[model samples]
Target: MAWALLLLGGLFEVGFTTCLRFVDGFRNVPWTIGFLVSVTLSMGLLEVASRSIPMGTAYAVWGGIGALGTVLVGIWWFGEPGTPVRILLILALVACIAGLKLTAGH
Candidate 1:
């Protein structure tokens, strides 16, 4: 359950980050609102998940998911470069995130 919440929260983190890309420094009203809402929901879910999950594990996983999601979205949706090395590093990060989850007692 906590991991599930962490996943959801991390997804929201991705949402907020992607929205940030489109916000135009908070000047674009709709995107700004999306950013604000996503950030709020992400943080709220993180806090809730922390209650049952170890803080370090939860945080690391959340951040990893957010980073992974952001990178994928950037490459797929924003025309960011997706070089071989970059993709390999992203996969390594996924492995590390999985390691953390497997070792975490939660």
Candidate 2:
């Protein structure tokens, strides 16, 4: 359950970060609201995840998933850079996240 919360937190982290790009320097009201809500929820979920997971491992996984998801969304939806090198880096991050999860041992 805590791992699930951690993954949810990672998803929300991606949401808030992606929304930040749409905020237009904090001028877009709707995006701003989404940013705030997503950030709040992400942090809350992280807190819950911390109860059962080591802080270092949990935070690494959280950040790794958020970064990977945000970059993938940017590439797929926003026409951001999708060079092969960049894609490989993203894959590497995913691998690291998976390694952390596999070794976390609940």
Candidate 3:
């Protein structure tokens, strides 16, 4: 359950970060609202997940997922650079997150 919450939190983190790009320096009201809502919901879920997971592990997984998802979204949706090294780095981070989760046994 906590892991599910953490994953959901990470998803929200990706949503908020992507919305931030659309905010156009905070000029777009609707995108800004979306960003704010995403941030709030992400943080709330993270807090809940923290109850059962260690802070370091949970935060690393959360941030790792968010970073990886955001980068993929940027590449596929926004035409951002998708260098091989960048992809490998993201993969490594994801592996680390999975290792931590698996080792934690929760």
Candidate lDDT (C-alpha), each: 0.94, 0.94, 0.93
* lDDT, candidate 2, at 56: 89
RMSD each, Å = 0.8, 1.0, 1.1
For model 3, the stretches where C-alpha displacement exceeds 4 angstroms are none
Q: Could you tell me which residue pairs clash in candidate 1?
A: none
lDDT of 2: 0.94
Q: lDDT for model 1, on a 0 to 1 scale?
A: 0.94
Model 1: residues with Cα > 4 Å off, grouped in runs: none
lDDT of candidate 2 over 55-94, digit per residue (tens): 9899999999899999999999999999999989998998
Residue-level lDDT of model 1, residues 1-106, one tens digit each, is: 8888989999999999999988997999999999999999999999999998888888999999999999999999989999999999999999999998899884
Q: Which digits, one per residue and each the tens of the lDDT, describe model 3 over residues 6-94?
A: 99999999999999999999999999999999999999999999999998888999998899899999999999899999888888988
